[model samples]
Target: MSLFSRRKLSEYEPNDHQYQLNKLNFKVTKLEDRIDNLENDWECASQGESFQLANGIDAKEAANRVEKAAQKALPNELKKAFDEINSAVKNEQQSIRLWQYKLGIVNGEPQWVRIYHIAALSRELKKYGYETKLDSNDSDGRFSSLKVSWEGKETSDISKIDPAKKYILPLEDTECEITDSVTGKAISHEVAYACPRDDKWEIIYERKIYSDAVVVPGKNIISAPNWVKSIEPIEAD
Candidate 1:
């Protein structure tokens, strides 16, 4: 029989409880062995050798002498340490203006210009009924944002677009798992790609021809996974 009760697979329990118990048991066993060894060593030492005092000095008197020596030396040592600290702080403050200017190099105009260009592109895409999506690239690279056109055709004139009416780019659904592609050994996860050609949404190209990375030109098809029998669209708060 096991030392612990058999927990059913269906039973509700904290995930790491058993792993934590195993760790605690290992630590307790190690501590017990260390304490036993220490006690044995102390008993052997006490019986094996005798302690002797130099110059016939008693233990209490010797301790008192050591205390006095420390008291005499400690104050001078402390003052030297404090003087070194004060010197460092003084030097740092004297050169602080130069240090502060070096930090300003990171907030330069080139960085601002890069950000301004990306924002301008995002704003321009919004006028063409295309919302700007952040790319999958880690550094964002040369392409700062992706222009997504779901319905095709420009939603409004570039000059007439209201900033508030701008559509947000559709975020990729992470919860959807690539079932067939992962198991069957395919390059792409997406099953199909849809695009608008003549006012009608159609699956212009099938899978294996291209990956989701190849934009469908008009719309980025992010459909529900096969595992999901039904999905309810939720309103943002």
Candidate 2:
């Protein structure tokens, strides 16, 4: 006979502690398998083999393509504006001497006009007897309001304000028309200054009287093939 009789199969059973231990061992084995799989994946990725996102795209390559697309989507005008600003900074131009502000977006494009440029425009406008007001908060670097008035008529529309148009070319001999202040009639006068004012020349006649300095919208006085040229960036102290 055996030294100890073998227990019947129905009578054999695992204790509570043994049962819990078996469950814990099974979970640990599963966790170790997952860690091994992660390490293998990292090794494959480092070797540039079988390392693509679920969408069949390499993560780094996808990021680079997205960045390029974003850069290409920038408008040409915006790009040119940035280049001009960068060149000004590199050359230490006076236009960028003072703090600059991006007033706002116009026609879905950003306005890169600086404070110096606005001040120059204001001075020129004042020379023509136009009242210019710059209502801006420098703290935020954006114009809170801008107003331009001529003869009691005011316009706050930025679309109507053209920096290039405000430029007064030195063509005193040019012939153009001017409106009489009292008679409200068009009078011919020698153009003291030719301004590019929205598809025409805003003519300033030789002032014979105090009120004669008014600007009159007239036909193109410049007939030279290269009459229109790029405006130089304003430089002022």
Candidate 3:
């Protein structure tokens, strides 16, 4: 009986090993099928036929289209930025010319007048039967100076004058009578020279003179000359 039981147990051990081998083979077959399906899905995505991105766009085609569009637009974007920078440089060059001196006749004598103040001097010259026009016949085809003509004859007599006297318009009284807030009395106060600023007259400099015995030098004051009130604002352009 002991010999029969031993032989039966040995037979059952071989059957259990065979069962485990069959189970491992089934698992390997299922793994191969999953790998084949993954390869098919990757091929479809690469061809842009079945696969889509989260935004419902074809992944492969969308990437190619976006890259091509960026390449095509890069030149135009660079050209626009270059044009804007060139325009700014030209504007700055024109502004620098405003501070330069130009030959013009002030009171029938040649003087080096500031380019920005040419319009103001021209207006003042009109009162004395003198006509003025901006001349662009220099090396550059832009207005660099004023051409003054009186009685139909242009003046070309260039001479040097006092630097302080150049570009000086006729002075007008800037005194105004205002009631003092502290004393409640009508007191006279002299303001500064009127300069053009934003289409209005702004006081730029002041003389120390007041009838109220008050020293207010840097006060904000806006006053225009009588001639400035009747004409348009001065501009270099």
> Evaluated with lDDT, which candidate comes out highest?
3
How many clashes does each candidate structure show, in the order listed?
A: 0, 0, 0
Q: Give the runs in model 2 whose Cα sits over 4 Å from its true position.
A: 1-15, 35-48, 52-63, 76-237
- Candidate 1 whole-model C-alpha lDDT, 0 to 1: 0.36
Candidate 3 lDDT score at position 33? 100
Q: Please rank every candidate by lDDT, starting with the best.
A: 3, 2, 1
Cα misplacement distance, residue 181 of candidate 2 (Å): 63
In candidate 3, which residue pairs get closer than 3 Å at backbone N, Cα or C atoms, i.e. clash? none
Candidate 2's TM-score = 0.25
For model 1, the superposed segments whose C-alpha errors exceed 4 Å read 1-17, 50-61, 64-237
Per-residue lDDT tens digits of candidate 2, residues 1-237?
Answer: 443544543244556667899999999999999999899999998988876447687678888775544333322222233344346535654232222355567799887654333443344434433466766666554544334344342211222324434323333123445679999898754434334445543334444331323332222222311111212211111
Tens digits of lDDT, candidate 1, 1-237:
443544553253555677788899999999999999778778878899544445677789888876555433332322232233235445552110000011123455333122223333334334434445544343534434332333333332223223333211221121112445547653444323223345533333234334343233211122212111011111112
- Local distance difference test, per candidate? 0.36, 0.43, 0.43
Q: Kindly indicate the candidate among 1 and 3 with the higher lDDT.
A: 3
177-196: candidate 3 lDDT, tens digit per residue: 45689998976544433345
Residue 132 lDDT, candidate 1, scale 0-100: 51
Sliding window of 10 residues with minimal summed lDDT for model 2: 228-237
